[model samples]
Target: QVFPAHGPGVKAPSLQDGQYVLQGVRALCLRANNTELVSGGSDGSLLCWDVTSGSLGRLVRTVQVWSN
Candidate 1:
């Protein structure tokens, strides 16, 4: 589960029909400008997406193994 930086609670968006899924999410980090969200998932994948634009930004450069 991912949480906002403010620490209010975990941010879990329901997957409506057409929404993209960031599956197996393990860790989340904000981009340098704080306008985008980067998430590390259990599949050793990282995804970057823009918050305002609602568009995928870039793929993570490195793959990280997430241990359960």
Candidate 2:
């Protein structure tokens, strides 16, 4: 899941057809600056992404903190 850091250009994930299994992850934090997305997940890592590319979940970089 992703959330915008500030005003404007906020969007939600769309449902495709019926009974589709969606991905689950705990996002500890989120920040958006322009088209860039910085997210901290429960997997004990930080990821930078460009949300404008397709699913937009394209990871630009990764920083591992600690894993469970």
Candidate 3:
């Protein structure tokens, strides 16, 4: 999902170095004025990612949702 910083409608070069891959995520939510991304998925893990480089940045906070 790389896009031009100036023209977001335009596609840009990927930042991936091919040494790593991000996986198992769903329902993306963006915040921090579009600089930060957040999502939770089937792994029952919620994570916030860096939008600029598309890397797993920091472990912001976590929550447990008990399934009945």
Query: lDDT (0-100) at residue 40 of candidate 3?
Result: 66
Count of steric clashes across candidates, in order: 0, 0, 0
Please write out the lDDT profile of model 3 over residues 2-54, one tens digit for every residue: 43433424232222332333334446789957988887643345678888878
Give the deviation of candidate 1 from the true structure as CA RMSD.
Answer: 7.2
Clashing pairs in 1: none
The reply for model 2, stretches above 4 Å from the true place, is 1-33, 54-68
What is candidate 2's lDDT per residue for 1-68, written digit by digit as tens?
Answer: 54454434333332333343332234633454566666554333355666576244644444555547
Error of 1 at 51 (Å): 1.0
TM-score of 2: 0.34
Best by TM-score: 1
Candidate 1 segments whose C-alpha is farther than 4 A from its true place: 1-22, 62-68
Better of 2 and 3 by lDDT: 3
Q: For residues 1-53, what per-residue lDDT tens digits would candidate 1 score against the true structure? A: 24555444433332333344444566888878989999776456577989888
> Regarding TM-score, does 1 or 2 come out ahead?
1
Measured on C-alpha atoms, candidate 1 has an lDDT of 0.63
Question: 32, model 1: CA deviation in Å?
Answer: 3.4
